[model samples]
Target chain A: MKTRKADPKGVMTGAHYLDGDFALAEGALAAGCRFFAGYPITPSTETAERFSERIPFVGGMFIQMEDEIASIAALIGASWSGKKVMTVTSGPGFSLMMENIGLAAMQEVPLVIANVQRGGPSTGLPTLTGQQDMMQARWGSHGDYRIIALSPDSPQECFDLTIQAFNLAELYRVPVFIMTDECVGHMHEKVVIPPADEIDLVERKWYEGPKDAYRPYKPDTDLVPFMIKTGDGYRFHTTGLTHDERGYPVINAEVQDWCVRHLIDKIDKNAEKIIKLEEEQVDGAEVVVLSYGITSRVAIKAVQDARRQGIKVGTIRLLTVWPFPEKRVQELAGKVKAMVMPEINMGQVVKELERSVAGRTKVVSVPHCGGGVHDPDVILKAIKEAVK
Target chain B: MSPEAKNPIENFLRMDRIPHIWCSGCGIGTVVSSFADALEKSRLDLDKVAIVSGIGCTGRVAGYVKLDSFHTTHGRAIPFATGLKLGNPELKVVVFSGDGDIFGIGGNHFIHACRRNMDLVVICVNNFNYAMTGGQVAPTSPEKANLSTAPYGNFEYPFNVPYLAEACGATYVARWTVLHMRQVTTSILEALNHKGLSLIEVITPCVTLYARRNRLGDGLNLLKYYYENSEVRHGADTRTLDIRFQEKITCGKFIDVEKPTFLDCMNTHLTKTLGEKFRPYGV
Candidate 1:
């Protein structure tokens, strides 16, 4: 294992080992993974296969369940049992998993789900990469509540974002999605696997009092419940329906409003703390380039190339997609006269950008369908036109 | 574990989801009561047990139980409980579903779940008809049995749950009607405590539906048939029970075979295939 060489401040240094997927996955194991359950689907299958191969060798459990529902259901059970758990699936499988994903949402089970998005609605373009699930990742699960989602633009981000997914899931006790398109998921890029001492590991919060006092579903002041694992000798209820502080089913209108709004507020209030973005050369730029996931890689390159030709174009890559990062965009949206958004789908983030910018900047989308990535030239042209 | 005073059944009940949706004079209530009695007698910790229910009148098993229970989508409880058990090798998970729910719409899941030999217990209440949705014909309803769907008489061949379970890799299979509450409770607890997929098929009656339609009298009279005509035996042959029950009703702990539950074999083999030492995130 080529480990991450670190300085005094623990800032990351140089690269070693294979590319992003392996490094991030290894980091997850080292960070305390005990269970990995998944269904074999393309682009993301290698991630599942590798985890299946590795999890057992490392004193953990691995299961290739019948379908996506079983896979996620297994993951939630494992997580509830004090295991660092995760599952990986592609677009179609992810669609099947949305119900359980919503269960994880309603039950507040902390876990990681990596979706290597592919094309189309029903088996659209399985082998090809498309960022089509960009919107689905945030809102696919029925009902309103906030969730934390991160998008990775490269192989390194794919690896790094996976660990980040586990960390965020643990931090907030919510399901975390690592939105990686096919380009990012399958690529073999140089990535250093961080050493145990050099990397930070996160564990789920638990009740420190007596087992009797521990409410696996009791809400903290933050509205997040302290969940104790099944074997830990604590009693708590986890319901898919709207629930009370004890986790029992609550059908009353007022309690429903409180639980739903609180679920949203947990993410919303902490948006500033939870959201992460990558901004490049936006200081005194007229046109800003916006994108996320693998599309952001092309986006950054487009903006960088435009800047080389003396055009004042910059880039803002959303590392966190679901929280929306409205404040960051609004502040930067005002400074930039126009913005160009490029993504795999017809148009998703552009709408969010349009909403945040409120017409202060001319917004344009360089849309690409299933087959492949949006060309860098296409994004560059959209930026130049927006600037003009 | 006493039956009435200091009732062992109280240990497994939610005490709140009851009085359940099960109708008065319903056989499901008897089965549920029997389940609690079995659990209490077996002396299993409530925390280690997970009772999962599918959609049906009998699917309320999870709701009434205090253990880690799940009231899942219709016909999907088997898979859901399979996931729960597979993830943790330590827990005893049970699927409590009704005949109409399991053999009718969820027949595929039921057969597949049994075939896997998933380490869990399955307590199925064979009430013959879909009582909750009003008198509807179920897959287990006797040929020529009348229900709303089969008002003229069911031309379809009904399922024999004991034979069904035996064919589907069940390590332990049995049949006991709700009329024999003590025997049914013992069979249920035996299934609960047993490893692998153990299914106890309770030949229950839908008093409100099947009883009213066939004039099987009331719940008391319907239960009377179970008491007088029911047969008890040693090693009740599962293969021949369904065939023999073609003319004669045979109910007992029919098939109890020894097979490694799916969980034990899966974990042990995975560990062996994986070799000596591997723990994902430790030094």
Candidate 2:
């Protein structure tokens, strides 16, 4: 995929103090997102508020949809109509969006969704922070498909990874998630926004072939297909139902097999290029603390404490949570004595970690129910236990 | 028939995808034919027109149409169409789906889309019961009608679709039966040109399930019933448009008035407030 500079009109260059949610909105604008349809949900509403305030000046559109379900549905429509679209919500809204998220995936619409995490099972803790939705972001929607999810632990990453999320969504033609928790979403920090020319963006791949020969689902050299806008005279049809390359519904098992495989392979085959991790001092370490989102920040503190006690602890922060980084985890499993994961949920991504480790090393999960982040001492104890 | 002798509407349909999944004697095909005829008469840029459908028998309409059609999740076509129109105000977005899909599961979207006056033409095929799901009782199924779920007889009051559309602020509201083919086509064309949330409810027969369960015979019998019992009242008060079991079916245009669409209101408001800073979206 080729890269382009951000539209200068949407970029606000310079350093400023902003929260994670507001920074996310700025990042989306910098990445050329022209349409945002969102509903109000705590911890995430600030993103929508910021977007509504700025998008009009940028020659873009913002709609506060009736609900989260309608919000996601609108994003899919706007995306097909030749716009980079997005929406933000918390757990309750995220649940309402699951059905349409699947539709967006099946239709191969490029979209960015920011789920500012909160404690949840059912409206569990709307105002407080929790990373419980980590797994839900990966598998909340039904089906055998893959999506790219990025976890931002601070306001700076909230600004940076969100632009990356839009780029990946355009490059792969799939829904990309900015999975940040309430701590980061509400945490105020200094964020540096580069000039429009300095910020790179991936443009949506548009089909430029003869209108008669255009097929909405025909894959390019890459497994991803090129898109055409609704008013482009292509007269193409696309549906959520399993379809053929022509974008017409084909219900037979053969077409279903092809459709499902294409959706999965586009990301699975390119997982290495899609997944990003930030590691420190992992070489020959006896224990590694593996975490993502806000939990990773807390876990790093524990890692530093362990290292001071001569525990030889290293830290691996997951920047991209989905597409699991299985190969890297498997390789590290053989060498490390154990890996300690502390997340807000009881045990979510830790299961994926254990699966990748395949029992090669001890895996300990420091689980917190919700409403708050984990204390560094608790994670430190888990690391100590894993080493023992 | 040879390829040269294809139907006139073949230009607007995916001929290869036919024969469609719609059952024999189903009136959905007749509605589709009317829609195609309307498209032809409107002479709007086919490329600039998009169709969106929710999941159901009518949802399949998107698949058969040779346009930028979207068969989205159940009960989401309205909001989806809203996005399409706002994304590119130059495009004419249409929502075509069944009564169950529109009024049952997707009632909230319908009301809100109408409330917002989203610029889209909505063609709702009201086949009393949930025909696609094996004749289950629907929000549109009249009281005392037999259905799969309401085997003893449906006791639920059916929605007066035109009334609901009017109450929710739809700019154009009309109703017609499949038997009134030319009228359906005329209303569709008018709605297409109308620049707000326009709704045309086409009462059609679900012969395979709805008719069989209600003992209403097949498509022809229903058409005969419509011919004998239907009344054309163009300006009837929408509040009196409730459909009753085996009763006179009221049909005609009940509401048609001009109002700024969602985009129109948005653009005007933003342009006024922001002055030179705002570039009117999709102008």
lDDT of 2: 0.92
lDDT of 2 at A266: 94
lDDT of 1 by residue, B107-161 (tens): 8667767777877888888888888799898888888778898889888887878
Which pairs of residues collide in candidate 1? A57-B278, A58-B278, A58-B279, A58-B280, A59-B278, A59-B279
What is candidate 1's lDDT per residue for A1-388, written digit by digit as tens? Answer: 0123222222233575444455446545655666777888876787776666666555666767777776786677667667778887789999988877877887788888888888987898888889888788889988987778888877767767776787788878899888877777777777765655666656577777876565555667766677676644453546576777756666899988978887788788878988888887789889888888778877777887788888998778889998898988788777888888888889987888889989877889889986698778888888888888
**How much of the true A–B contact set does each candidate keep?**
0.24, 0.86
Q: lDDT tens digits, residues A1-388, model 2?
A: 7789999999999999999999999999999999999999998999999999999889889999999999999999999988999899999999999999999999999999999989888988999988888777888888888889999999999999989999999999999999998999999999999999999999889888888998888888888998889999888889899999998888899999999999999999999999999999999799988999888888878888999998999888999999898999899988999999898999999999999999999999999998998889999998888898
Candidate 1 residue A285 Cα shift, in angstroms, is 1.9
The top-ranked prediction according to TM-score is 2
| i-RMSD per candidate, Å | 3.5, 0.9
Question: Candidate 1, B32: how far from true, in Å?
Answer: 2.0
Which 10-residue window of candidate 1 chain B scores lowest in summed lDDT?
A: B274-283
